[model samples]
Target: MQPPSKPAPPEQQATEAGSVTTPVRGALASLSLAMLLPALGTSIANVGLPDMAKALHAPFQDVQWIVLAYLLAITALIVSVGRLGDMLGRRRLLLAGIALFAVASALCALAPTLWLLVAARALQGLAASVMMALTMAFVGSTVPKARTGSAMGLLGTMSAVGTTLGPALGGLLIAHFGWPAIFLVNVPLAAVALLLAWRYLPADRGGAHAKRPVFDHRGTVLLALTLGAYALAMTLGRGHFGARNVALLLAACVGAILFVRVELKAPGPLIRLAMLRAPVLGAGLATSMLVSTVMMSTLVVGPFYLARGLGLGTAVTGMVLAAGPLVAAFCGVPSGWLVDRYGAQRMGGAGLCGAAAACLALSLLPASLGIPGYVAPIMLLTASYALFQAANNTAVMGDIVPDQRGVISGMLNLSRNLGLVTGASVMGAVFAAGTSDITGAQPAAMIRGMHASFAVASALILAALAIFVLGRALSKP
Candidate 1:
């Protein structure tokens, strides 16, 4: 299962003409599949949540916790696991993650109670964090740096496909088989991914190197506390805004300060705070969070408006919802090529501006509009995100050294998960507040709520764009 001879480093591979050999192609394929699973799992669960609620007879808040728990685990553990992968072996950690994810999916499928399902999902999410943290590093380490954007584009395409197809697929399965079908479907696919990874991905030569940095236990603990408490406060503070939520938020603030202090003093930091001092990396990470927040807010609200408010069937809703990511998926490869040909700054800025415009358009849509009204705006929004993701990721990774790719990958993923949690919590609360006084039958109220959510998302995206522009301006010589 080892490479016949040690392959040249990625930077060296980039210089050789036509270096995408069979082994390289194999590695990309393996990484793409690994990336697809988590994205699909997340989207499928979003589509299937109502069915699970009905099957388990759980309250709305309880069922929402299933997604929240999964997100929290990933946000808390991603950086630590990523550092471990870099120190140990990325291939080794990725395989273990794939296996554990498969088992956890089975656990989720078989869980008899809602709490058990949440627990299994949390386990599944932890495994997903590992994959998320290392998959980009795998690509960077295996593929040539010259073609990094193209490789990332392909990976991005796979993720967009997962997001694009997941709702439709989940709706079909749930309608015919049940909510559990969503979980069961992952088992065989994960088994296949595990096999491919075992055969194709490169072994970590760095693992044999002595003088590896020590694992930062204190920094890891502090980061976990910071992310965990923040996620908890964001998730629970909506309706249950009590002393507990306040305390948790305060704890998160303290934990963040402590984490910074510990990382500065630690011999081996979980995340190199100094790396974030680089404008490209920091701005890229922040932009990712903002884009994800906007997208997730729309995702959380759009389906509800379509299904419950408009009385559309799940199948129809899924089809309508798929349009955005489908466009994004189709554009992914080109977006990457564009980043390589031009530059990340240009592409990233253009994407953000497009996204802002789309968000504004969505906010202006009225209650009387049909599914057709949303198609163009959704497509524009998701396509913009795809463009931004491909370019921004390339920029961030390109700036970092080879050895730090794993941690950077984890940080990128951490930003996305945190954004999702924040968006879902804040946007859901906004929608709920907007519509709370009206009866469920009042579709207009729901539409108003949806518009409010979009408006808030638009404002956030604009703020993000402002920050990005300001940072770029300041960084100029």
Candidate 2:
């Protein structure tokens, strides 16, 4: 047997011809903080929605737009901005994004009307897209190739932390101050991140090193339309199903077809469909999406089961639910170590198995078993997501050349967002279909719905596992 290789040190390298050396330590902290803000921002407002609605005197339908607008903007614009980062410069774009996020956050905090707040949130989402797209690009560029998994692990850790904190923190802020406090919280985080990023991050040397690529204006627009329509359809499918949802879904399908055609012919495609044929890249992305779908399903369904099925209060349910993301956060660094040592495929497969097991456990366990039973499966599901994300991200980014990191990162983020929305749509439909009448749903009916949702989620994860296996088989030497 071969002796274990020594781990690689965190070393700096020049990301461009004339760029300053990538600061491994500082860059990790800076990038993690930058990534954390948007992740937190995405969910922080969820707990504040009711508070905001009350304060603004807005109906539930209008308040829904606050979250929807942000999500839509990010989904629509991230890939284009990521490609822009590849063209213009990651550092330049990141700084601009941070500044914009801060400013928009302020606007959200001060907005007197629901419509104005929604608009501010949209702007914040645009800036967030830039930050989210470039996060891996910057990290991948900063760290040595050998330690990419470790760095990605740290990024995953921050993401888990942000997700865990968002709701709890938002609730606290809303109770103490107001809904505006939720938005105001971003100001300090973004400011600190911006300062650190400005001081330690390198300039746009990657763009300088590579030949100037033509911007694909047409491709960007079509892709944006596709994502926008798709997101809207998914969001609407949760409840507001009718002509609007059908029309938006149809529009999404048409936009997707148009995007494919445009990209195939465009000199500078937003996403290279050919490049996506690579087994590692394509399979990694698919696995990422599936993993997120499973995770999101648990997230959306678990709370309902806890509160409605088990008769737990919101506070207790929230605490019980918080266990998953908290475990995920703790799992990140160790999972990164595993990825760096063992390669992504093994870890990714293991993670998927864990997810499948968690889904099965959740499906089988009765709500009568209470929080104890839920805790174990939730931890497994959350940790599995973090594990899969860390390894899959390393694999995908590793497969790409440095020059295209921004777009790939954007694509990865896009997949995750899509998975989240898709999971919500699919699982929500399943649960709703099972319940038939939510307002008059009995505990038994709700429990049945939860079980059905989890069963479907497990089946989906198994399918993803099969796909991963096939991808490996096809990629073999």
Candidate 3:
């Protein structure tokens, strides 16, 4: 089912003046839709975790691990897969990822047990990693450099919309159809995206079939170790702050050292460490981690607060909880535009400031007040998330040269997920600690903790900014 990508009448290909046809537009739409599929599944799962556990008869931590495992695989493999895509063929890899994801998703929907579901989800993550790490590259392939910004801006908002819609959609599916419905939703989206990707997306035509592939095994291993160890510490450190936690942290440090060494020595490293020396890329990646914590924390606490604390139904909670990302949807495009026009440093700073202010507002909410009381803060949080994320993405991707773009994108994506995992652990602990003492009124206390956690998260954002500033200072001419 190859697409009819005729050389567009030599004159059209030669001159940029020839407007794209409806067919080409459909093709691009198909690619854009494909770009968004993995996110839909991930977002749905985040809000539907409780329902998933009930259906699978799993414990809370185990259910959490299901999500973690997917992320682990994605984070660990994205960098390697991404660069490989650049060297080989991004569209080919993307289609492969789409097919793999569809099958894994089917497995998840029909899983007979929890373990199977976990394994399926890990495969899904791997597929998602490929899609996310290379979709932007795909955009570059489809559109000229002049049109890339608008394409990127639209894609950014599309992600925000997907994320915002996912929770509500998942909740609605779970309410009547049960947890499997959430996974099942992917069947149609993936099927269509796969079709378009197969038919429309162009082939990669890089420096292929030339130099021997210098696979960076050392860099790969060290990165896996670093992220894995850090995730382990976050997942386990709570309730037992002892030798185990220390060892995990030490392991992370060791892996960081090893990874730096590998990047320094490899002929063609997995992630070019020299790129990290760029202010925009480094700052963007650092901020990605910080903003991700906000998502992790919000996902865990928001559902719980709406369902258990306020006694609102999960369905209602899903609707209410979609606000943050919905706001993100509204702001994401403009933020990308801002990143293009202004320096990433300035834009990133502005977003951080907004986020900090939002957190302060969240902290100020009293238990006596209701959801409306929190609405303003939530809106701010949403706007800030959209702005920061768009800024970071543009900055990070903009910093790198074309050849290494995929791997760099993967690394940046990994940073965002790493932030999410970190946020989940830290915020979960904070909320848990805050609720430990109370018996009947634990709900109120939990809200209090979540609010406070937002405060702490805001502080972390500032810390990230400080790092960005320091990096800038170090790079002074």
The prediction achieving the highest lDDT against the true structure is 2
C-alpha root-mean-square deviation, each candidate: 3.9, 5.1, 4.9
TM-score each candidate: 0.88, 0.93, 0.84
Which ranking of candidates, highest TM-score first? 2, 1, 3
Report lDDT (CA) for all predictions.
0.84, 0.86, 0.74
Candidate 2 residue runs with Cα over 4 Å from true position: 1-22, 206-211, 237-240
Per-residue alpha-carbon lDDT of candidate 3 for residues 62-175, written as tens digits (9 for 90 to 100): 888677777777877878788888777777888888888888888998998888899999889888888888877665445544344445666777777777677778879988
Worst 10 residues of 2 by lDDT: 9-18
Prediction 3 TM-score vs. true = 0.84
Give the runs in model 3 whose Cα sits over 4 Å from its true position.
Answer: 1-28, 46-64, 144-147, 172-180, 206-209, 236-246, 301-318, 337-346, 367-369, 432-451, 468-477
Candidate 2 lDDT: 0.86
Q: Candidate 2's residue-wise lDDT over 1-477, tens digit each?
A: 999988533333343332324466777888999889988998898888888888999998889999999999999999899999988888999999999999999999999899999999999999999999999988766776767787889899998889889988998998899888999999999999999889877666653554688999999988898899989988884745789988999999999998899899999788889988888778878877877777777777877788888889978987888788889889998998889889888998888999999999988887767789889988888888788888889878886776799999999999999999888888888877777776678888888888888899889999889888888887788
Candidate No. with top TM-score: 2
